[model samples]
Target: MSDESEALFDKADTLDEIRDKANKNSNLEMKLRNCIKDSMSKVDSLLTRNDTTQAQLTRHNELVSFMKTYCHERAYSFQIKKCQDVSCNICTPIRLPQTVFDSLHFLPDPVPALDNPDHYTSFQAVYGKQTSEEFRPSLQLNQANAEPAPKSVFASGKIRDYIMCCDCGKWHYVYSDKALSQDEIQDFKQSLYTYDYSCGAPLFPDNHYLAELLFVCVKISCDTPMEILYYSSQKSENSDICYHCGTDSDFIDPPVKMVIGPKRPRFCGPTP
Candidate 1:
């Protein structure tokens, strides 16, 4: 018998014992009978590996109901396991370009925020700390005659450039304003196409939260480079676990913006 069929048989046998111990007209007996009649027959006639039969689907639903009753009444518990089976296809193991991975260099690790755990405070977070705390009676007196402060150069907005390492599947950006020329752009597109990409640094630095966990891209070894909206935030020394892959990584600052490329791709392995 199939593993699924054998499992159902075992469940049925267990339910039978429960049925015998209960009143003949009990709900337990009714539930078990319904499971066997509606679900088990489908499991018995299973014909293929991938496709699930309607009877098998019914069996699953019944087993869930049966278990719910068992757990609630008997105070027992069960856990659902995620499947991690691999496909037998020729395609997979998409590798990233070596140059992109090589280009990744270490940025100084950020200091952790004292209050908000997920954020790292930079120099800007502390720049005004000491000066702002001083009690300046003269400054307060001159405030009425003070002209509006001029806009800081740092506040003048400018777009940034980014590149995704096809191997790691992570996007990286140039902190400077040097744009890639048409030839360089074309060259990057051609060379990285079809190369394998596995996210190497799952805990790498990010602007806010790591962009890998927030963004999803499926560029084969051949597609043209794509643009994406990325949210960068202030990062800290502490890391947040990815909700999807469960990898530990840092978060970046608050503002989200468009980025052109990938950082080292965060590895998202098969989940169990």
Candidate 2:
């Protein structure tokens, strides 16, 4: 009887192993399918709009900015444990694109607004106080004992409510369930195509809320992706962190106007 019981237990363990493997394979397959489908949809939409002109490109650029915020969030799966068990061969080391990682780290570190024990303070939170004040806002300061905040806005595995427009200062609601709906995103692109994009508008500075963030004075009559030369240094190939802003990219050049966050704080010190 003991021999029979032992044999049955061994069989049960093997069956459990098979079930676990099946479940894992299903999960990976689902993630890959979603990613590929999303990419294909984007390509198809662009193809249909192949007659896109420069003005249309500007409009699409706006959509791209909005899409980028939403799309970039999908890069890592919140549902998956990035680190797996020690026995798992793929669990040894985690590597991400160094440039991307550096940019991700820039917003929350040494930004002056983010280093506080509470992690952030807006100008409203500071009100009648000096910038040098300890940014402790609440009358009770409950965050002192509150649980640490989640890293990403969409930690609940869903997109957030609305995206703020960089231009026109409007909010666009997004629906994540369907793929590539010709919603306000497409409309936004069309608006740019017809827009004269006249100059002399209040342009948002390249770097915002930096202690030394400054505006670029350009008199160009046309709308081009404005570059902000805050500082200069020749970096080696591997490092993508720009010395001033703590991030670098060929993408998302400055004067790319933004609506939300502490934008283009005026320098009371030296002019840039």
Candidate 3:
């Protein structure tokens, strides 16, 4: 062959080699891109699983803490003493004290005055402020001015009373005067056991005396029979009364007082 023809053949071979290299480079780049995408997808999935696990761990920790604080064996039985005064008629219909009645004014009325005329009129006369638009009856006014009202039928001389757990010595308030039915007692117990720690304790108004009553009812119903006591006079040593939990009071330590922000800690117990 001529020299020029040989050079042309060599050039063709070089061109073919260059094309093969280019194709190989393109395939390598594509493989690298796919590998990076797979790695990133795995990383994202791992992150999601880690976050879920962390959330589960936090919830478990909260439940464990709550269980440590509240769960314990039944060491005491609750005792409620009804007023046995022959002349005192406070327990007939369970009338609320003046302070409790006044506190009700701040709450949203479930039944508006227009909806229930009789209830509204009676409530207004007793609790509502006297104004030109709303005039209270003369009889109620006379009764209000006549004399200071007597103490409540409650042993604490209030609409509600506090009783200490005989086992833990933690004070819990009782709001309801009437006894709970069997179904109600079981429901209360279920609620107490299944309470979610994630939501924290249920919030109640400062005057919500019934907040801790369910705890008392559950203890009385499930663990032991309630011990009924009687008080003839308000001066009786009722404040010192506690549930008859089998544990000795002398060995029980007082619960650590829990305080909320910018508010005085309650002596009875935590808000719940």
The candidate scoring highest on TM-score is 3
- Candidate 3: residue 56 Cα off by (Å): 65
* Clash count (model 3, backbone only): 4
State the lDDT of candidate 1 residue by residue for 120-183, as single tens digits.
5675655424323122344445664442222121111222333455543444332222345676
Candidate 1 RMSD to the real structure: 27.9
Q: In candidate 1, how many Å is residue 159 off? A: 7.5
Pairs that collide, model 2: none
Query: After superposing candidate 1, which stretches have Cα over 4 Å from the reference?
Result: 1-177, 201-229, 233-272
Clashes of 1: 47
Q: Write the per-residue lDDT of candidate 3 for residues 1-272, one digit (tens) a residue.
A: 34643443445466566455436667544554554466434323232224455466445553344334423322132222224345533223336774664454321122326657665544445443422323235545665444222223233223233344434443344434456667655655554454422111231323443343332322232144222321222433344322333232343322345221222122222222
The predicted structure with the larger TM-score, 2 or 3, is 3
- Poorest lDDT segment (10 consecutive residues) of candidate 1: 150-159
Model 3 alpha-carbon drift over 4 Å, by segment? 1-169, 196-272
Candidate 2 wrongly placed segments (more than 4 Å): 1-31, 39-63, 67-109, 112-272
Q: Compare candidates 1 and 3 on lDDT and give the better one.
A: 3
Q: Looking at model 2, which ten-residue stretch has the lowest summed lDDT?
A: 227-236
lDDT of 2 by residue, 1-272 (tens): 14543443345466566455446667544554554466535534452335367566545553454344333222122122233235533233447765543333111111145566445556455543433223324413655533222223212122322332344322222222223335534543454454333333222233322112211122322232222211111212223222222333432333324221222212222222
